[model samples]
Target chain A: MAFINYSAREINCKLVYYGPGLCGKTTNLKCIYERTANDAKGKMISLATETERTLFFDFLPLALGEIRGFKTRFHLYTVPGQVFYDASRKLILKGVDGVVFVADSQEERFEANIESIENLRDNLTEQGFDIAQLPWVIQYNKRDLPNAMPLEELREALNPTGKIPEFEAEASNGKGVFETLKALAKLVLAELKKGGK
Target chain B: MSLTPQLVLLEEDQRQILDVAERLVRDANAKAVYLVDKNGQLVAEAGELKGIDTTSLASLVAGNIAASGGLAKLIGEEEFPTHFHQGERDNVHITLVAQRIILAVIFDDRSSLGLVRLRVKKAGNKLSELFDAIFKRAESELGDNVESPFAEISEEDIDNLFSD
Candidate 1:
């Protein structure tokens, strides 16, 4: 549900970073906040608990370089990752224009990723967004971990549908982070173009 | 009907906001800057952007924040005061100004943490007053009914919005 004011030529889209706990969502945001040029993005806000767990949600607003004379901007959010925070996560997904499913690359976190993906689908349905048609990308994170799960196995369970783009990421060192975001941003803008307004 | 504040209505105030935000941008080295009322109207924006419908987009972003805030309230959490998005290559920061409107900045690889915070702190009060005056006028026009804005929505309009 977007609130569009035609008086100004700016279009704001909401993109949420969603996935299992500790799958590098906040890390991905931190990377973007750090890497974006001083002129293309904005402030990066994080409302995390003192212990570093996301207290509620992580929000970042990106100012994409203008397109076709219109300024394209996106606000990115990340829901709390812990299971008990399901309610909080749903709230963050309310008006999301796109989603990035960050899957923990460790074998132990495989079930978490699957459960999270299911939760994402159910939640999107509740929010009136067609998940199948949504602009979504998958990030297989923690690639640098010594005992990580195989990419094929991770993809089979997380993205077996073969629709969304997927990327490998080592968020700590900033690998594959921008690629995932750029892909999703492109998809989001593309969707808006077809739909107009 | 009361005479609304004349200095801060829509485009007139927007020009002022852009000028002020540009200063904040230069002082802070912020990549992008925008102002939104509490209900999420795009007051002004200055930066390099393409492929965005700013008017609707700013309103929607603010709406996203407000909805998310309501959702947080329902779940019994404190208002999620500030939100930031960290990407691999870029970062966005939003500051709640005077607890009225939002002053947002999108900084890329060049901005330092200290600079962004300092500029936002400096520009916060000015932005707050600018938004408050504008929101007050909007409220007056939509009075006599809290949901009046949507009362005018035709069935076709609703269907079009809900359509895929």
Candidate 2:
């Protein structure tokens, strides 16, 4: 859900980055945190294991300038992608305004990617959100890997609809990170403008 | 089970909420009080917030509540309405208001847990009433098909935000 404070002249939205384990979900957030100007970003919090695998989520708050007089603030989050953390993932999606599904482009992780997207759809459905209606995009990460699957193959499997915007990204190098974010943000704002859920 | 997409807080609504929060801070003799939505958005805060990262606090508090709520369900309960964390120098008393917002009081040597809990209960009730009224107003406004403030937003406006 979006929080619009007329008194403060600010609008806050929640965006979630979801994917399978080791799919670069956390890396995407870290890249954005590093690239964002200090004044435009807040502290990025990661609840992860000692080995740095995400335990619960990683949160980053960004000030995406203003729309009209309202300051547009986005709270970005990434759920722990390990299968056992399904509970945490559902909790993080409670009030999501938009989502970015980061699919690992590695050929070996193909099945894992499908399983994760199915998990995403089921989770959203349990929360009463239809996957087709939500403002979301897909990011095919690890594009620089030697064993990465072809873009068309990934799309044919994951985004069969071909209606959702898709990006090819290598999050560690920050490629296509902001592009994915900006596209999702634009969709979210457009939804708000239409006064739709 | 679909949740509302937007929680619109108008100026008058904020004043009423802050008034309740400020009074709770004084009556509880606490260092600070914070009201956060279930989505982890900070609705309002009162008292000496210096040195406190309110944004982080709000998000963590919401996470705590959600996790705790999950635990409650595992035990066949609905939800835990209150949570207390006792520290050597300070303590936090968290309460759920109308199951929609969190009312948290951070207190130290100046106050006791018993007093903070008592005051929070009263303040929580008042806040619940205020929120119910606000929701009603918002729903009625929606029924009237009031124009969204962002209805006039242009693609250029969105492009400009990312231009920098």
Q: Who wins the TM-score comparison?
A: 2
- Tens-digit lDDT track of model 1 for B64-136: 5776677679889857767777878767788787565677788887897677877888787787777676557
TM-score of 2: 0.97
What is candidate 2's CA lDDT for residue A193?
78
Q: For residue B151, what is the lDDT in candidate 2? A: 80
Candidate 2 recovers a fraction of native contacts equal to 0.65
* Complex DockQ per candidate: 0.05, 0.63
The 10-residue segment of model 1 chain A with minimum total lDDT is A1-10
Per-residue lDDT of A1-197 in model 2, one digit per residue for the tens?
Answer: 88889899999999999999999999999999999999999999999999999998899999999899999999999999999999899999999999999999999999999999999999999999998889999999999999999999999999997999999999999999999999999999988877732
lDDT of 2 by residue, B48-158 (tens): 868788889999999999899988998999999999999999899999986789999999989998899889989989999998776676666544544567888988888
Interface RMSD of each: 13.0, 2.4
Q: Please write out the lDDT profile of model 1 over residues A1-197, one tens digit for every residue.
A: 22233335455677899999899999999998998777766666666899999977777777774444345567788889999888778767765778999999998998999999999999888766678888899999999999899899988888887777999999999999988887887776666554432
